[model samples]
Every structure is written in C-alpha cells, then in structure tokens.
Target: MKKNISLAILAIVLLVLPLLFQSRYTQHILNMILIYVMLGISVNLIFGYIGALTLGQAAFFGIGAYTAAIISTKLGLSFLPCVLCSAVMGCLAGFIIGIPTLRLKGPYFAIATIGLNNIICIIFLNWEHLTGGAVGISGIPYASILGLQFDTERKVYFLLLVSVFLIFLLYRNMISSHYGKVMIAVRDNELAASAMGIDTAKVKVIVLAISTTIAAIAGAYYAHITNYVAPDAFPVMESITFLIIIVLGGAGFKYGPIYGAVVVVILNEYLQYFEQFNMLIYGVLIMILLLFLPSGIAGIVEIAKAKYYEKKKIYYLKEVGIDEMK
Candidate 1:
C-alpha cells in the first residue's frame, strides 16, 4: 500500500506536469513522449514479460493506423469502433505470424520478425488503392468520445492522459499477477519453466497477442489524433525505438515506458540543433548507457536504493545500541 501511494503521487505529478508548459512545441514533445511510452509498454508485454525479441512490432502499429484510417474515412465508422477493429486485426496478425515464427528462439526469432516487418512495409508501400501507396492516406479525423470531438491539442492531451493511465494500470496488474510470475520463470529459464508444466509456447503467443493488441490500440489513437496515416510513419526504426525503450527502461516496471519515452523524446527535441548528426549522437548515447548501465536508468535507481537501505540498516542497528550484540 505504501508503494501504491508513492506511485499514485507520481502519476498525479506526471499527468499534471504539462500544465506548467503551455507552449505548443513543448506540448508536442510531451505528446511524442506519451506515444513512445505507449509503444514501450506494448513492447514490454512481449519483450519483457514473454522474453520475446521482436523486430516486427511496427508492423502491427502500422496495420492499426492504416486499419483505423481506412475504416473511419472510407467506411465512415466511429472512433471507438475503429480502434476495436484495429486491435482485433493486430491480434489476428500476431496469432498468424506467431504460429510459425515465434517457434524460433534468440537471434533467429529476432531475424524472423525483422523480415516480417520489411514484408509488411513493402505491402503498405505498394498497395495503392487502399493505402494510397507511397502517396499515403490523409484527412483522418481526430478522436471523439460520444459526440464530443477532440480536435484541439488540449483535448488530445486529455485523451492521451486518460488512455495512458488506464493502460498503465492494466499492464501493471497483469505484470503483478500469477501469470506474470510464470512469465518471469520462463524468462529466467524456459526449459525449467517447461519442466515445471508451463506451456511456454502458448504463453509466448498469448503475450504476443496481448502486446500486439495494445500496440494496435496505440496506433489507432495516434492515427485519429494526428489525423493522417502513411507507411513511412511506421518504419523499422520505429520498432527499434520500442526495443530501445525496453532496454533503456527496465523490464517489469510499470513506469518504465513513461521514463524512457520522456527522456528520449526530450533528448531528440534538444538535439534538433545537430540535424542529421542527432541520429549519430543518439546511437552513441544508447551504446554508452548499455556499457555503463546494462539495466538502464531504473537499474541504476535500484542499485542506489539498495545501498541507501544498507546504510539505513547500519544506522538503525547503531541507534538501538545493538552494535555489540553481533
């Protein structure tokens, strides 16, 4: 309960922090941060929980974006229904692709996903009639709940905040459940987990499906909020961004997504002065973080916390006059 209260306070701060910065550019950066947070959390469901190294997450993301765009524009469907359909489409894609490719492990599995993402990109680029091909889809609508439209940036921020809060809660609960423990076992040692009667393969697919669904939902919201869709928008680099998020934020942490997202997005904003050199600098930063802190910033925090507690333990013992008792 104490931990819960701490996190609750943190969440309140995060949700309200935007109020301090009313600049359009600042809000734009915040929006990007939230988007990446969604992506990171989605990837966390698979990469962190199921121990899958996926390079095809953007495939589902693009699909969801396109799905929502096409349906809402051509079919004239509403926002919520469009998002639901995209999620189902993403789940199906995960089910189909996961069946054959998820069987592979380690680098092989990663390679398969890379290939899959490329294939989807090709289709998105060439499918002119539906997707508009390289020309891209445009004029998509902003999100609307019931009759109210979220056309303004402020409204969009509110929408993102609500969705992020709900999804964060959902993933947090799942990660702390019995199933989450089984996933940790699988991640620690698949063979041992299997021996212990866990259906490792089935669990992987389920995690993939859930992760894809979440990604799709994020994509759908993005499409509506941005009011556009294009294949180039969901490139392989985007998938890498998700992986970087998981690597940079620590696995199994609910706020890991938000932390990595805010850091990277804000860094990119500041690095804009470097133009293309910004990309090189970003790459170097990732390498530096990996070398010095393999578990990322959260890992560093945990290390500091442990040391602090150790000192506390000693101080408490001394204060109790029990130092000689040992």
Candidate 2:
C-alpha cells in the first residue's frame, strides 16, 4: 500500500513537472532519463535477478532501433508496427545468442557477451546497405498514436511516461511471481537450483529474451524521438552505461533504475565540461559509492529505515516505562 501511494505521488509529480520546467533542454534530459530508466530496468532483470552479466545488451538495443528505423523509413509503417517489429527482432537476437551462450558460466558467459557485442557492432558498421553504415540512417518519423504525433520533447515525455509505467508494472509483476523466486535461486546457486528440479537453462533463456525485448522497446522510442539511428550511438560504452545505471540505483530493488537514471543522466550532462577527466572523475565517484554504500542507493535507504525503526522502538520502550511508573 505504501509503495503504491509513493508511485502514485511520483506519477503525479512527473505529470506536473512539464508545467513547471518549460525549458527544451531540461525536457530533453527528462526524456532521456525515462528512456535510460527503461534500459536500466532491462539490464536489472538479467544481471540483478539472475546474475547474468550480459555486456552486449546494447546490441539488442541497437537491433531494435535499427529495426524500427528500417521499417519506418523503407516500409513507411506506423509507430506501433515499427515498435512491435523492433521488439520481435530483439527477442529473436536474444534467442539466437542465449541458446548456446547461456550454457557458459560466470566469467565465460561475460566474455561471450563481449564477443557478441563486438560481432553485432561489426555487423552494424559493415552492413552499409541496410544499416547505413557509419553514416547512419536519418530522417526517421516521429511516433504517433491515433494521428497524434509525438514530435516535441514534451510530447515524447508523455508517451515515454506511459511506456515506462506499463513496463515497470510488468517488471514488478514478473519479479514478484514464482518465476522470480526461481530466478533468485538460480542466481544464488545454479547447481543447487538444478538439483532442486529447476530448469535453470530455460529460466535463463526466458529471462534473457524478456530483458532484450524491453531494451528493444526502449530503443524504438529512442529512435523515434531522435529521428535517426547509427552504429556509433549503440556501442560498448552504452552497454556499460546501462550496467552502471542499475549499479548506481541499486539493482534488484524496485525504483533503483529511476534513481540511477536520473543521477547518471544529470551527472553526465554536467561532467561533459570536464571532457578529458570526465571518465576518471566518474570512476572515482563510483569507487567511493561502492566503498561506502556497496549495495547502492537503495541499500542506503534500507539501512536508514532500519535505524529509524530501531530508534522508534527504543523511544516506545522509554515511554512505556514512564507510563508504568505513573
């Protein structure tokens, strides 16, 4: 009930924020935050829930973006169809990669993802006819619903707001189900989960598919909003950023992605001035955060809550003693 109330309040805040901040730059940043939140959510599903360190998540993201771009530009399809196609492409890629690769464990799996990332990048770079090579595909159409085009940043935010909310609910539902428990069990000890009659391989593959699909959907929105798609836009750095978003926000916790995305996006904007030292400073900050709050911001919140409750309990005991004496 409390969580629901908080979410409702948050929804209201997001809806009213545009009225307060009319700056185009700020609206653009807000839109990016929403998209990155979706990306963070996708990453958390696999890495946080199932402990699958997939470093090539951006490949799926790119696949979705390119898919939407191709369909919209070539076939002149509507936003809905393009988005759906992008999702399907993402799922197909995930299935193809997750099949043989999911069998690998630990660092081996991580290494495979790196290789996957490189392979996908190469394809995007070299597939000039289809993906427009390094020059990228441009002039993509804006998204629309019932003839209403999301052409401006503010308009795009409304669409993204709905997308993020629906996706977040679905994510919450998935993580709260029996499947979620099994994924946690697998994350803790795959061998033990397998011994307990869980099909660990199937669970991993299914979760990967779901994660990739979510990333693709976010990518579709990005492509529509940006009106372009390029290989350079979806690189290893983007995947790293996705992982960092979850880490900073507290992966495995609800609302962690939202916190992480907001911080990272705003910090990134400000840090761009330090250009050369940006990454170094960013690394230092992350190191400090890990050292102090190893579980990220969400962990800190949990710790604070625990402390608050402990103090309240002690205060209640003292009050009870005073009443007995009276």
Candidate 3:
C-alpha cells in the first residue's frame, strides 16, 4: 500500500510538473513525449521482456492511427470505441503474425519485420481510399472521456498521464505474474524454458499481442492528439526509435521506457529545432548509445552493483579481518 502511494505521488508530480511551463507548443511536444513513453514501455513488453527482435511495431501503430482516424471521421464513432477498436485490430494482427513467424529464431524475425514495415508503409502510401494515401487524414477530433473533452493542452496532459499510470499498473501486474516469469525465463533461454513446461511459442504470441495492443492504444491517442495522420508519422524509423528507447533506457528494467522516453523526446525536440540536421543527430545519438551504453541505463545500474560490492568487500575485510583470530 505504501509503495502504491509512493507511485501515486510520483505520478502526480510528473503530471503536474509541465504546467509550470506556459508554452502551448512545449506542452504539445511534452504530451507527445508522454505518448511515446507508453509506446516505448509497451514495446519493452515485447522486445525487452519477451526477447522478440521485432521491427514492425510502427505498422501496428499506423494501423491504430488509421483506424481511429477513419472511425472518427467516416463512421462517427466515439473516441473510446475507436481507440479500443484500434487495440483489437493490433491484437489480431499480432496474433496472425506471431503464429507463424515467432517460431523463427533471432535475426530472421528481425529481418522479416523490416520487410513487414516496408510493406505496411507502402500500402499506407498507396491506399488512398482507406488511408487517404500519402496525403494523409485530417480533422480528427480531440480525445474525450465520460463527456469531458480534453480540449486544452494541459487537460490532455493530465489525461495522457492517467493513461500512462494505468498502463504502468498493467505492466506491473503482468510483470509480477506467472506469465511475466515465463516471459523472463524465455528471455534467458527459450529451450530451457520450454523444457520447464512453458509454452514458449504461445507465450511469445500472447506477449506480442499485448504489446501491439498497447502500441495501438498509444497510436490512437496520438492520432486524436495531433488531429492528423500521415504515412510519414508511422515510418520504419519510428520503429527504430522505439527500439532505442528500450535499449538506452536499460532494455529489461522497469523504468527503462520512461527514462528512454525522456531522452528520445528531448533529442527529438532539440534536433527538430535544427530541421535539416535532425535525423543525422538522431543517427549519431543512436550510434553512441549502441557503442557505449549497449546495455542501456539499466545496464549501468547493474554494472555499478559489482563496483559497489567490490568496495564494500575491501572495507569489511579491513575492518573485521577473520585471519586475525587465527
């Protein structure tokens, strides 16, 4: 209960902190960052926890964005239903993809996903009737809940933060459950995990379905938040960004996505300010992170543990030498 309270307080702080800055554009960017935080963490559910080397996450993201846009614009569906539909679509897609391809090992899955992303992107670009093609969709209404519309940036911030909290709870519950243990075990050794009676393939499918659903939710919120959806918004590069967020945040760590989101978002804003050299900067940062922080921020924490214990060992040996009695 105390731990829950602490998390609640921390969440409140994060949600309220941005209001101190009064710029609308800044608020908007920050809200997008928060969106990515959920997306990033959700991806970690697949990539980090379940050990899937997926690269087509943005395809699901695009699916959700398009679903929400089409539903809201064409069918006049409410925001929550549209968003939920997007998640359902994502889960279906994940299940279909995972059933066959998840049986493949490592790099093959990653390579296949590259092709998948390209295929999705091209379809989105050419499917003018459904997706509005390359021209994209517009006039999406802002998100609403229980008759309360989030019309202002600050209100949206609170709304998204609540989502972030709720999803965090979902993550915590899953990660602490038997299913999460199976995921971690699979991450360590799929063969051994299967030997232990864990259905590795089924687990992978379930995890992928969950992760993709979460990503779709993020995408739905993003479409509503931006009131626009373009093919460019769901590029293969965004998938890479998601991977890096989990990697640089310390792949398997609980807080990895949040820390990674802060970095990616900050860099995006800074580089976007420069326009022409922005992608180059993103590439450079990714390289640096890959080279230096390969294990990510979570890795740093683990590394520090050894050094801390080494220092403690020396201090304790000197202070109370067992050999002195001998």
Candidate 4:
C-alpha cells in the first residue's frame, strides 16, 4: 500500500514537472533523459540480467531511427507504424547478431558486439541512397496518435513518459515471471543451467532480441522528437554512454536505469561546458564509481534497506526476550 502510494506520488510529480519548468530546453533535456532511461533498461536486460556484455545496442538504435526516418519520410507512414517497423527491424538485427556472437563468452562477446557496432555504423555511412550517408535524414514529422500530435517538447515529454512507464511495467512483469528466473539461472551459471535442461543459448538470444527491440523503440522516439536522424548520433561512443548509465545507476536493480539516466543526462549536460575535458572527466567519474560504489547508486539504497531491516529484526527479537536467551 505504501509502495503504491509512493508510486502514485511520483507519477503526479512527473506529470506536473513540465508545468513547473517552462523552459523548452529543460523539457527537451527531460525527454532525452527518458529516452536514455529506456536505452539503459535495454542494456540492463542483456548485460545486467543475462550477463552478456553488449556494445552493439547503438546499432539497433540506429537501425530503428533509420527505419522510422525512411518509412515516415519516404512512405509517409504514421508514428505508430514507423515505431512498429523500427521495432521489427531492430529485433531482426538482434537475432542475426545474437545467434552468431552469443556463442562467444566474456570479453569475446563484448568484442564481437563492438565489431557489430562498427559494421552497422559503416553501413549507415556508406548507404547513401537509404541512410542519407553523412548528411542524415531531417524534418521528420511530429509523432501522432489518433488525431493528437506531439509537436512540442511538453507534449513529447508526456508521450515518452507514458511509453517508458508501459515498458517499465512490461519489464517488471517479465522479470517476475518464470522466464525471468530462467534468465537469472543463465546469468549465474550458463553451464549449470544447460546441464539442468535450460536452453541457455536460446535465453540469451531472446533477451538480446527483447533488449534490442526496446532500444529501437527508444531510437524511434528520438528520431521523432528531434525531427532528425543522423548517422553520427548512433556512434560506438553512444553505446558506451548507455552502458555507463546502467553501470552507474545499478545494473539488475529495478530502478537502476531511471536513477542512472537522470544522473548521467544531467552530468553530461553540465559537462558539455568543459568541451575537451568532457570525456576525460566522465572517464574519471566512472572509474571512481567502479572503484568505490561498484554496484552503483541502487546498491547503496539496497544496503540501506538491508541494514534497516536487520536493525528492526534485532529490536523485535530483544522485545520478545529472544536476544536475552541468545
């Protein structure tokens, strides 16, 4: 009940946030943060839960962006159809990549993903007729559902917020289901899971596909919201940034992506002022976090909760004279 109340309060706050901050730039940043949160959730599924490190998510992201851009601009499809097509393309890419690369373990898998990212970026760069090459696709129409058009940052913010919430719900449900337990088993010990009759390979591929689909959806949102799709936007560096969000927020934790997205987006926004030092400072901060906070910000909250419950249990035992007996 308390949890529900808290969630309700949070929702109310988020809904009113735009009204409080009337700056278009600020709202735009908020929308970007939401998009990154979705991206972080995607990474969290494959890396955090499935224990497969991936650096090629941006490829799927780009695929989705381009899919949306091409279809919407060339074919004149609506927002929903564009997003749907983008998701299908992203999932297809995921399966193609996951089947070949998921056979490798540890750093090999990570390296394969990096190669995949590079390959996809090259395709985006060279495919002039399709992807617009270096120039990129611009003037994407605003996203619309029914007759309602998301033409303003404030409108886009609500649309994204709703989408993120729905995705979060689906993610939560998936993690709580039997398949979620299977994913954990695979993550903990793929060999053991395989010995126990679990198709570890299949699980990894499924997770990867789901993750890529989410990433692509986010990309679609980005394309529409920004009114442009560029090859440069989905670089290898952007993939790393997505990984950093989940790593810093708390991989495997429910709210990790949300917390991490807010922090990373805000930090990046401020760090832009540093220009040449931006990446340098970002690297140092990540190193510091990895060294000290290892599990990220979510881990800190988890520890606090554990300690609180432990103390409460001790107090209860003392009250019941159990402590005296011990």
Candidate 5:
C-alpha cells in the first residue's frame, strides 16, 4: 500500500512538473533529467543486471543521434521512423562490438569498450560527410504524432514523458521475466550460470544490444528535441555519468536508476553556481556518499526500513512481557 501511494504521488508530480516549473530553463533541465533517466536505465540493464562495465554507451548514443540526424535531414524521414532506424543502428553496433569483446572479462572488457568509444569518436570526427564532422549537424525536425508537432519545450516534455513511461514499462516487464533472471544469474556467477545451461555469452550480447537500443532511443529523442547532434555531446564523460547514476542509485535494484537520475540531475543543477569548483564539489560529494553509504541512496532506504521493523518487533515484545507480568 505504501509503495503504491508513493508511485501515485510520483506520477502526479511528473504529470504536473511542467506546469509548476514554467521557466524554459527549468523545463530544459527537467527534459534532460528525463533523458538521463533513460540512459541510466539502459546502463543498469548491462552494468547492474549483467555485470558489464561498459564505457562505449556514448558510442551507441552518438550512433543513434547521428542516425536520426542524417535520416531526418537527408532522407526526410519523420520522427517515429527516424527513432526506429536509430535504435536499429545502435543495436547493430552493440552486436558487432559485443561479439568478440564480450568474451573479455573484468578490466579487460572495460578497457576494450573505452577503446571502442575512442575509435567511434575518431570516426565521427573524420567522417565529415556522414556525421558533419566537428561542425556538427543541425536543424533536425521536431517530433510529431498525428499532425501534432512538439516544437516547444513544454510539448517536448510530454513527448519525452510518454517515451520514458513506455520504456519504463518495457524495462519493468523485461526484468520481471525469466530472461531477467538469467541476466541476474550471469551477473552473479557467469561460470555457474553457464554450467546451468543459461548460455551466458548469448545473454550478455542480447542484454548489451537491448541496452544500446534503449540508449539510442533516448539519443533519437534528443536529436529531435535539441535540433542538433554533436560528437562532443556523447563523450566518455557522459558515459561515466551514466555509470555514476546507477552506482549512486544502488545498482541491481529496480528503481535505482530513477533515484540516481533525480539525485544526479539535481546536484548538477545546484552545482552550476560553483562554476570552476563544480567538478571538485561533485567529486567530494561522491566520495563522501560512497565512503559513508556505499550501498547508495536506495540502500539507505532499505536500512531504514529494516531498522523500523526491528524497533517495531522490540516494542511488540515489550508489550507482551508487560501483559505476561500483569
């Protein structure tokens, strides 16, 4: 009952957030929060569930963005089709990268992904005709549905909101299914899962593809909403941010990404005032949080809940003792 109520309240807040924050800047920040939440969820699918530390998420993210930008500008494709194509591109990239690379474990896998991102960045820089090089692509069309154009931030907020909700449903359903269990098994113990006939390699590849697809979808929306796609936008730092989101939210938990997104986005916003010290402050806070609450914000909540139940049990025992004494 409490969980349901909390969800209901969150839903209501999301629905009315745009109206409450009428400023364009605030709306833009909120939209970014939505985007980061999608990215966080995607990262969680691999990093949390499958135990893969991917640094090439921004590569797929850039691929999706560039895909949307090129198709929309050159082919004159509409929003939905562009999004689909971008997701396909991201999935293909994931497949190609994961085939030989997924076999590498631990730091080796992570290093390979970092290398992949660098290679992709170089490609984006050199492939001037396709990706517009360092100058970047611009003037992407606004997303539209049934003749309704999402041009303004307010309108874009609704579009992104629906997209995020749909993706959340898809993610929730995916994680709740048997496949999710297999992924978790792979994360916990790959050799054991393989011994159990789980096909660990295949599971990792599929989950990686799915995670890239989700990130691409967000990239697609970002291209349309921002009307631009720059290679610099999808840097390794952005990928790091995605990882941080999962870590701060307590990876492996279902709602961890969302919690992480809220905290990260709000922190970023507040730290803007610090300017030069923003990163320093950010690092300090992260260090403190990890040092004290290593399990993250979600873990704190879990600990509190456990303590509450313990107190309640003790109080009940005391009451029983009093009755017996009487």
Candidate 6:
C-alpha cells in the first residue's frame, strides 16, 4: 500500500513538473535527463546485471536514431512505425554483434565493443546516400500518436515521462521475476551457472539484445525530439559517457539510472562553462565520486536503508526484553 501511494505521488509530481518550470530550456534539460536515464538503464542491464562491460551501446543507439530518421524522413512513416523499426534494427544489431562479442571475457569483450562503436560510427559517416553521412538527417516531423501531436517541449516531456515510466515498470518487473534471479546467478558466477544447467551464453546474448533495444528506443526518442540525427552524436565517447552514468548512479540498483542521469546531466550543463577544462574537471569529479562512494549514490541509499532496518530490529528486540535476556 505504501509503495502504491508513493508511486501515485511520484506520478503526480512528474505530471505537474513541467508546469512548475516556465523556462523551455529547463524543460528541455529535464527531457534530456530522462533520455539519459533510459540510456543508463540499458547499460545497467548488460553491465550491472550480466557483468558485461559494453562500450558499443552507442552503436545501437545510433542505429535506432538513423533508422527512425531514414524511415520518417524518406519513407514518410509516422512516429510509432519509425520507433518500431528503430527497435527492430537495434535488436538485430545487438544479436549480430552479441553472438561473437559476448564469447570473449572481460577486457577483451569491452575492447570489441569499442571497435563495434567505431565501426558503426564509420558507417554512419560514410553512408551518405542512405544516412546523409556527415551532414545528418533533419526535418524529422514532430511525434504524433493517434492524431495527438507532441510538438512542444511540454508535450514532449509528457510523452517521454510516460515512456520512461513504462520502461521502468517493465524493468522492475523483469528484475523481480525468476529470470532476474538467473541473471544475478550468471553475474555472480558464469561457470557455476553453466554447470547448473543454465545457458549462460544465451542469457548474456538475450540481455545484450534487451539492453540494445532500450538504447535504440531512447535514440528514436532523441531523433524525434530534436528533429535531427547526426553521426557525430553517437561517437565512442558517448558510449563511455553512458557507462559513466551507470557507474556513477549505482549499477544493479533500481533507481540508479534516475540518480545518475540527474547528476550527470546537471554536472554536464555546468561543465559547459569550463570549455577547455570541461573534460579535465569532469574526470576529476568522477574520480572523487568513485573514491568516496565506490558503489555510487544508490549504494548510499541502500546502506542507509540497511542501517535503518538494523536499528529498528535492535529497538524492537530491546522492547521485548530480548536484549536484557541476552
């Protein structure tokens, strides 16, 4: 009951959040935060849950963005179809890349993903006839669903909010189910999981596919919301940034993406003023955060909750004279 009430309150707050912010720029920032949150979740799945450090997620993201851009601009499809196609392409890319890449372990796997990101970026850069190459695709129509258009920042916020919420709920449910336990098992000990009859390979591939699918979905959203798609936007550095969001937020924790996205986006916005020192400062800040909070912000929350419950249990035991008996 409390959980339900909390969810309701959160939903209410999100719905009214746009109205409170009169600045379109501020609203746009909020939308970007949500987009990054989705991306963070995608990374968290493969890295946090499956224990695969991927640096190629941006490739799938680019694939989705370009898929939406090409479909919507050239084929004149609506937003829904474009998004669907983008998802399909992302999943296909995930499978094609994941099959061989996932077989490698640790740093090797990570390196392969980096190569994958570079290859995808190259394709986006050289494929001018299909992807518009370095120039990119523009004039993407505003997203519409069943005749309702999302043309304004405020309207787009709602669309993204709903999408994020739905995805969050689905993610939560998946992690709570039996399959979620299987993922945890694989993460903890791949060899042991395999010995126990779990198809560890298959699990990793599926998780990768799921992760890429979400990233692509986020890419589609980005393409439509910004009315443009560019090859430069999905570089290898962007993939690193996505990984940073997961690490900074708290990988494997439910609200890690939300906490990480808000902090990273806000920090990035402020860092823009530094110009030449932007990356230097960003690197220093991340190092500081990792040093102090190795498990990230979500880890702090989890520790607080654990301590609270421990104290509560101690107090209850004392009240029942258990402490005195001891």
Compared with the true structure, the alpha-carbon lDDT of candidate 2 equals 0.91
lDDT tens digits, residue span 104-188, model 4: 9999998998988999999999999988999999989999999999999999999999999999999989988999999999999
Among all windows of 10 consecutive residues in model 6, the one with the lowest summed lDDT is 317-326
Query: Whole-model Cα lDDT per candidate?
Result: 0.86, 0.91, 0.88, 0.93, 0.90, 0.93
Give the better candidate number (2 or 6) by TM-score. Answer: 6
- Tens-digit lDDT track of model 3 for 303-323: 798789877777777788643
Off by over 4 Å in 6: 324-326
139-254: candidate 2 lDDT, tens digit per residue: 99999989999999899999999999999999999999998899999999999999999999999999999999999999899999999998998888888889888888998887
Off by over 4 Å in 4: 324-326
Candidate 1: lDDT of 295? 80
TM-score, one value per model: 0.95, 0.94, 0.91, 0.97, 0.93, 0.97
* lDDT over C-alpha atoms for residue 71 of model 6: 96
Better of 2 and 6 by lDDT: 6
Instruction: Score candidate 3 by TM-score against the native.
Output: 0.91
TM-score of 6: 0.97
- How well is each residue in 1-326 modelled by candidate 6, as lDDT tens digits? 99999989988998999999999999999999999999999999999999999988899999999999999999999999999999999998889999988999999999999998999999999988999989999999999999999999999999999899888888989888999999999999999999999999999999999999999999999999999999999998999899889888998888888999999999999999999999999989878988888898899999999999888888999988788522
Please estimate how well model 6 matches the true structure, expressed as its whole-model Cα lDDT.
0.93
Clashes within 3 Å, all models in order: 0, 0, 0, 0, 0, 0
Residue 39 miss distance in model 2 (angstroms): 0.5
Tens digit of lDDT per residue, candidate 5, span 1-326?
99999999988988899999879999998898899889989999999999999988888888888899999999999999999999999999889999899999998998998899888988988899998999889999999888899999999998999999999999999999999899999999999999999889999999999999999988999999999988899888788888888889988878888899989998999999999999999889878877886777788888898899877777887877743321
